[model samples]
Target: MANARVDRLRMMLAREGLDAVVLSHPHDVRYATGYHSILERWTQMEPFAAAIVFADPARPAILVIPEANLGIVAVLNRDGPHCTFDEIRSFDMLNFCEVSRYVDPDRNGGQLAEDAMAIAGAIRGTCQPDIAAAITAALADHGMAGKRIGFDEHRVSAAVAPKVPHDYRDALDFMMRVRVVKTGEEIERYRAVGRMADRVIAHAGSLLHEGADWNGVQAGICDFMVRNGVIPVDEGAMLFGGSYDGDDFIPDLFRTPGKRALRRGDIVILETQGVLDGFWIDINRTAVIGRPSADYQRLHDILRDAFLMMVDRLRPGVSTNSLPAIGYEHLKAKGVPAPEKLLVVAHGIGLMPLEIPLAYPAAGLAGVKQGFVMEEDMLISLDSLFFGAKLGPCHMENVYAITAGAPEPMYAAPLELIVADHAPADRASEPA
Candidate 1:
């Protein structure tokens, strides 16, 4: 069966009149080839792996990686359907795998001879000395030399431009455009991760108490996520307090967690992100350590209602640019103070938290505006925040699957402010 993702790439490549696309970005490579390497966890100081996707669907995509990853790729091809690349090419980097040792039946008891032989076979005619030469050789072997090729990152383009005589163009936007729409498999992965996020948020809410500090709460969340098979990303768990000095948004959105203990009536902005099988989970839920003041209650209600209203308006053909306006108008109608301070952003979520076709204006090559219109099967994260000096920061974010009718919430968690009353004797406080 033809992979829908590769089909989408071919359609995009044909539309752009390009012969192929070279993807060096970790997420891009995984999206194209379905091969995730541990080395990709590091930022691309230098190009590590590349996936060459040809415009012709009949031409199987090629994945280029270091020789160290050959065993994993061979095992994936042998044991399961995880690795999607039809052809695997490798380059010599570190001498991590010694095939001779593994293939020795008497020395190793022949336990891993099959896998070792597979790796050795893959490295025979397909391996090169370095990334640049591997990509150059792959292109030349596939008759892509001197053809129009799109490079997802500039550094990868620069590295390969010297070795291959091809017309290379920047394709960051093009790849984002192709990735905006989710496939069935991608949607299932999102659903799974969304459920995981809901659990993490619940666990985080349970950990909030009068004396709990940001560091402890964050550590608990990270531990819970990792134990449940999700890799935490970014700040892992960001806990913002109710203390800010300006009308602008939180100055350091990605600030590390501190050891300040929670106090009675303290507003805590609990935000988290994690990854499962290349899909991301970004969720935000606000909580109060004790009873919320009237101002805090009113602000949270308005933002929550406005967020729900906007979510209801999420159907096919709705422009993402219209979402923020819906939120602002609702806040203004509710007589909320400084309604514009209630920042509203709706973005696509998949391999990355913020994918293309953003709600805000994004310009591409030649000053072309990149705006998104909601489509079926697209996953969107609608985030709303209102940082009131008196009430602290109130936030609520939800992931929705854009359908033909109403948007489907990926998780069943209600959008309500959690009130974690430290004292059970405090009967006046109600549950969130």
Candidate 2:
């Protein structure tokens, strides 16, 4: 799998006249190499790690890792479709942390180390500069000493940057361009995860009651997913519920969950975010606590139409820049109000919820440049968050992967307004 990814990257890099590239950012490293650790979430330090990819097939990719991470990274790639890098180089922070102690950092600690010297000369050859030397040695050995090098310039480490003897271009650009599409293996993983998340959404919708707090609904969904082997553990994995009772929806969709209680006739927005294996799904569905109002049905119908209209155009040959006009024409045909503001109505999804091929200001789709062209095997989510004071807010989202024939929805959920009524035994006095 990684071989295919590397091949695709090599072709793109060749176009840009780059001889080799290195990955240092966590997400890029994970996607390119399939070597992920919970520790990669560090905001301050990533232990200054990197994974190198040389354009020359004869020369293998190398990982510049802190001596501490070598063993775990090896075990991580042991049975997975991870990068088959030929070399792994190690660096040491002799004072704050020792290379010897990292042989089994979390497990045996110093127990894994053999007798070491007490003199400073013993550790003199192991320091920050040593990390650069290791990388430079690889480049010199490969005849790439003065070739164009690619890396995330912002995240580059001083200890690691000066060793490169060539021009630097942001590796992020190439990565984003290629990440728009999903491979067969990635699509399968996403479908499995979306299925699990769909069940969690349905189960949580069933558990909604007139008086239940958002916390209960979130817990119900998360616990169900975890217990059923969807999420491996409770590592801050979550679900969110918002009581958008009478235009109270949090426009910023990613706000943290609160104890807002569901009242009668309230439109409960439940978003289920689940991680299966390593893939993620971002799905949202609105359900009413009791009977939904006429406006609820109207909003659901119009938004679903808008969403489907956008999705229908998500074919391999389609230009993503045409989404807004397609949506406008569809709304006009359906006699629904034309959306005044079109946000990220469609976007690609993969190892993360949002990937490349995204719409609007960032990709300049809504303005100057023609948007990203859809390629085969791209996974995307068509979203509709159209709203007005009179129309109320309805958030509808679903996942799909573009194919040669037609795109396919990952979930089995029907695109309709779900009227979720609480059982009599669970009912209580309606709140204002």
Candidate 3:
């Protein structure tokens, strides 16, 4: 299945008129070659591995890794279904030293040698060349170094840019487009994320009420997520939009939790979004403190129906531009008001959470527009919200895997408005 994924990427590269690509972005690297780097720890200075993905299926792919990580192959088992790369180029910092050029106390002080291995046995130091240089050199050796190469522009080190020609294009978007569809192993990883989301969302529900601080709820949710091994990412945030408390539209749907306290009858919207391994779980849950508004309850029903209606129409040939209106019209026909800048009701979520082919409400939608077709095995996240007066502006966001039959839920939380226990936390005066 992983090979099938890489094969798809190769096909895309061929279509784009590129011969080869160097993938160093952790997500793209893992997607192209099933070698999972440290989860949520992707940095510019990666010391472990990188992969050179080729556009031709018959041609073998290449991999560059630090020598220390060579032993990791025993556990990772890249020789089998995990990856398709055949050539392995290992770099050893220990080889960088001229031990004989230095003075050795034990050997009559002639030119002495001290490399990484020798230093580990005695001294310590840092190496100069990065993995990018080796990547550039490998591409050059293959005779495609000056051709239009596809590489992660952000990961291309200053040492490598000069080596690679000006024609090199950014490959992150193309790679992500290829990764929109999840393989069997990738879906299984998301299943684990589904489990984590259920527990974490339930935990957050128990702590909501008047006087419950936004930050406090965030802290409790973090503890639950961490306990379940769903380590959090700083860039990826858990949000709570105090929509009803404030007047007008909630300008930012991703408003982070803070010192603001929950008021009586305020609509509490919690979005549990995080990545597990490379898969993702993006869930939206809406609840109320005390009594609920009839309009809010009605809006929830309309949103729910609209969401289901869109899911029902999702098939291989369905147009991406057709989705948003399907959802938006359902809400509007049912008397639910559409909020300002209501866009991207649905999007593909896999490697980076928001992939492409976003569905817009109007004709001139500004995303991956009309002609793009939905395919089998594409993972999507639907975000539906209603911003009206009093209580919520209800929202329901969930991740689903598009199947030949019906879309499979990554994790199914309660769709109804959760009426929590009337217990208040700390102290607060309700807004007059």
TM-scores, all models, native as reference: 0.87, 0.80, 0.76
List the candidate 3 regions with Cα displacement exceeding 4 Å: 36-49, 68-85, 91-128, 143-148, 154-169, 235-237, 243-252, 337-344, 357-365, 368-371, 422-432
Alpha carbon lDDT at 383, candidate 2:
64
- Candidate 1 local lDDT, 1-432, one digit each (tens): 356788888998999999999998888888887887777787658768888899988777888888767666766667666767767777876554335225554564353555645555534246677887788788777877688999987766676666677898878878888898888888987888888888878887888777765666677777877878888874445534333233222323555535356677667777778887788878888888788888778888988999989899788898777777888898799887778777677788899888865322353421112347888988988888775555566788999999898988997777899988865343232122
lDDT of each: 0.75, 0.63, 0.64
- Ranked by lDDT, the better of candidates 1 and 2 is 1
Q: Report clash pairs, candidate 2.
A: none
List model 2 lDDT by residue over 1-432, tens digit each: 246666766777788788888777766666666666656654545445666787776666666656555555545645663544556655653443463553554564342222112112122223344445656666666676567888754445334456555766766767776666666767877888878767776776777777776666666666777777665223324443453434354433554555356677766665667666677767777777778887668767877777777888888878777776776666667666546543435677766666654332354443213566788888877766655445555677788888887788998787777776757465332211
Q: What lDDT score goes with residue 135 in model 2?
A: 62
Model 2 spans with C-alpha error above 4 angstroms:
45-48, 77-83, 93-133, 154-161, 225-260, 341-344, 357-370, 424-432
Better of 1 and 2 by TM-score: 1
Candidate 3, lDDT over the whole model: 0.64
Error of 2 at 56 (Å): 1.4
Model 2 compared with the native: what TM-score?
0.80
Model 3 residue 329 CA deviation (Å) reads 2.4
Q: Largest TM-score belongs to which candidate?
A: 1
